[model samples]
Target: MTTTLPPTHRALVLDQIGQPLRVETRPRPQITPGTAILRVLTTGLLSYSREIYSGSRKYSLPTPSVPGNGAIGRIVAVGPDATTLQPGDLVFVDIYIRGRDDPTVAALSGVHDGHTVFSRRMMHSEWRDSTYAEYARFPLENCYALNEKRLLGSPSEGGLGYTVEDLLYLAVQLVPFGGLRAIGVDMCDRVIVSPATGAFGSTAVQVALAMGASVIAMGRNTETLEKVRGFFGAAYGEDRIQTVPITNNVEQEVAGLSRFGEADVFFDISPPEAAGSSHVKSAIMSLRHSGRACFMGGQREDLGIPTFYLMRRNLTVKGKWMYERGDVVKLIQMVEAGILKLGQEGGARTVGRFPLEKWQEALDVAAERAGPGERVVFNP
Candidate 1:
């Protein structure tokens, strides 16, 4: 499946931050000595992309960078000495950066000053050809095998039909599960999730349920809560899921869930409107001794957390970034195996669709809430 292509391909390129992505007939990226080329299948824009673009997230984006971190694609070309992959292999690639030989373990662990890859072989890209295009060039170690059939399935009932949204959501929800054996999550753990309607929240609930955790989902809309419940099969039966609408007094809601404070993990994806950074501080107060709370969204201001509470509880506060190459493969498996479900109303459906030519519109739709099961997708 080696891809022999024309000299150039269509891609969305950004010359600067806060600028529109221009569709250009740029030269297809060549395979670097250690890299391979992939024909784009689908790529996901997780919360990090927006953060990186705006300079608010932990990761940085150099000017003239491509915007996606994870994508599923088929191998088109392989660089010299790249024996692990071949032309026509389906794979999911990671977003980490690769640097010249480095001395620290953090380089392999994804900690480089701003955009360097973690390991000497681990690769990171400062926007070198992303999934928003027809083809991408990736380092050999950064790519993982993907099942072509599963990746190509339709979303209709009985099919995985996952979109970039599903993949991105999977990436976001699985961050806590990475890094080594027994990443500290188990089935039936007490879990609390916030900002229940957004794509991130929706994924959190799905992952918690899949992992066998009891979820207490928070949001300001009963309608949205009901929608979420329906997605999990509670609409026809008594809801195993619970919901708390955001009221004027969020502290009260926070206090109410404190009874379950001994929760093993609390996932926060709420915006300021539903639960602000203070909400996480409060969640820390309610956590069981040695419990962990993960913040999955951005906070505009410093969140005031009482040090005494953290010290006494020994709380572990983690802010998730994005998924790694291997995580994406497992997520695709979960979806294909019928462990995870997606859709617009009852199942996964597109909220909006934009051609590659309308890149800005796609970004806008992704940023705003258009409707239920709404996700803006780019079909190149």
Candidate 2:
């Protein structure tokens, strides 16, 4: 079935760095082979959206682009090569797009311009337009269908009863899921998440708990740490989730973590401001023999790794970017199976919603509500 599409739609366009976003009428995206167009229901706003828009974050975004990373939407049309997806299907649009021929070349649609030369070229030449508009086009593989009936229908009518805004948590969950998967977190494994009060770190705790692993949430904020503990501890049992306040002193932090026993895995997703943080080292030192660690943080400074200690302990350390294609499918499955919850059940709440013209307000709210489980979205 094909739906009639308008020629133009309103979008929040970032004309260039350091300029205010403009809500302008733009031509609607046209579908091609291996691509699909979606009527975006909700696009999540990042907490640092203002920094990115103001050139403070230094993301290499192309000029005059619609900037949104991930969204939950309805499929409006599919390209000729498409087989399974159809019009009206509810799906989560993933922004991570890789070059078909050269998988190494990639770009985050509507977000980063790309780090490498090839990725930058791909971003500038194609995949630059993103989901922060009424309608957006995406690679066919990037659109994953959701269980529409179960997600949208009433619980009385055999549905999970989730709002479109609730599904926006998928975007927030994906990053931590990627890092956790990379470290091979398993059921019953004792895991430690450093700086677990932030958006991704807090979600890391959730994903870790959902995987049946016990989580030791470490962070500097006592209030937020307690909030995270209360949120998940209530569902998973207080004993299964533990919180440790990060003192930024390695010996003290390590001593605090040691009281919980050796952890099987240490997952760190610290932000740029957490450079040289003692939490990373403390968490690593707290791991058991043959333990694993995954770093998915934004710190630019080089970390001091205990080279001899890791060798002796047989510890495995790995770095992960966003996520793989298969990880997205698995994550959606986890959500559908009720193994991983969203919205109120998952401790997530949509704190604010804004229209395209109110992008600035949306960004501000997102920053203010930057803690775990707080969501701010655009109903574009």
Candidate 3:
């Protein structure tokens, strides 16, 4: 049932490419069958957005738009054609419309412009964008149902309900999940993740662990490495979770890792600016012969993964774009069923939260690499 509607709502509008986001009261979005309106609860701040907003992300074309990448919301209304989703339904906006087999899927909905990342949805266009706003009207193609009650320790099970904080972690998780899934991580695989300590790396580490693979978490910072180790060490034990401090000495780290075991897969979630640094070559150095390595959400413009390892070590390298709807659904089920634990380090992953008016602070924090497992959020 549709509830009483509101006329206007607040949003962090990005009118210029490099300028700070502006908070303004804009007209509320209208709902149509192919579209639905959500009362945006919380939107995540990705570290990559710092470069994205700074105009440093060479692959991203600038447009006047909202900067939010993903968010959590309750459906307030849906168009007549959108009978699959209803009012009061809780969900996370999974904003990638890529790799869909059906040609007729988004052709009529105006989701993608056939120009941006992977010829997929731009996600920040005026027609369809992020949730850094009080209200959002999104294509049904970008909406994924997240059943909170199904979560372990939910209010129904004498636990606090799945909070907006959970939504924050889930929002950035799609990239890591999609990347790992693309290479088809297996139970017997021993994985190595470079720069596995930030928001993106943290999610990648947790997903790899949950997939039942033995993981070697590598990071340059001792503090962040230990923090990451504590998270995985406690649950999977040190035997299954190995933490290594990265250095320019790739051969030494590669030799050191041999004591634990060889890595079958190398999942690289390093920041784009740091993409071609030591980690790219080091990841290849650590992989076992015929081992698979996949670049997860790294920028290709400045990234240079050396081809020497592929020719010499018999390595298989692959590129994964975004994600599929089935992947998001599977992740949600895993989290709800208690197979995956987000921010399992016994503290909130939130670095900070801001009201819509204080969005600039949130954006600044979102771009910085100041803390471990930190996630910036906007409550609109």
lDDT of 1: 0.59
Query: Which lDDT tens digits does candidate 1 get at residues 228-285?
Result: 8766646222344666665545477677666544567667776543434344655556
Q: Which predicted model would earn the best TM-score? A: 2
**Model 2 lDDT tens row, 1-380:** 45899999888899998999989897899888988999999999887888888898878888878899689999999998899999989999999889898987778888787789888887776687898899998999999999988887799998889998889899889999998998889999999998899889999999999999999999999999999999999988899999889998889988889888999999988888888888888888888999999999988889877777698899999998899987899999999888899989999998998898898889899888888888888999
Candidate 3 C-alpha RMSD relative to the actual structure: 3.6
TM-scores, each model vs. reference: 0.78, 0.98, 0.87
Clash number for candidate 2 = 0
- What TM-score, to 2 decimals, does candidate 1 have? 0.78
Compute the lDDT of residue 199 as modeled in candidate 1. Answer: 65
Query: Largest lDDT belongs to which candidate?
Result: 2
What is the lDDT, from 0 to 100, of the residue 91 in candidate 2?
Answer: 93
**Local error of candidate 2 at residue 253 (angstroms):** 0.7
The regions of model 1 sitting more than 4 angstroms off are: 45-60, 98-127, 150-183, 233-239, 248-251, 258-262, 270-278, 323-326, 342-347, 370-373
Candidate 2 Cα lDDT to native: 0.89
Which scores higher on TM-score, 2 or 3? 2
State the lDDT at 65 in candidate 1: 50
TM-score of model 2 relative to the true fold?
0.98
Model 3, 1-380: lDDT tens digits are 46888899887776665667787887888876677889988777766565556666643433565556678888998877775788888888865543345433321111223443434443334354457788888877677777666542555666435566766667566778888888899886898887787777766777888888888888888788887778677876677788877775767676767777668999887665565466667677777789999887454455656678788889988876556677888887777766776653323477788897886677688777445567787888
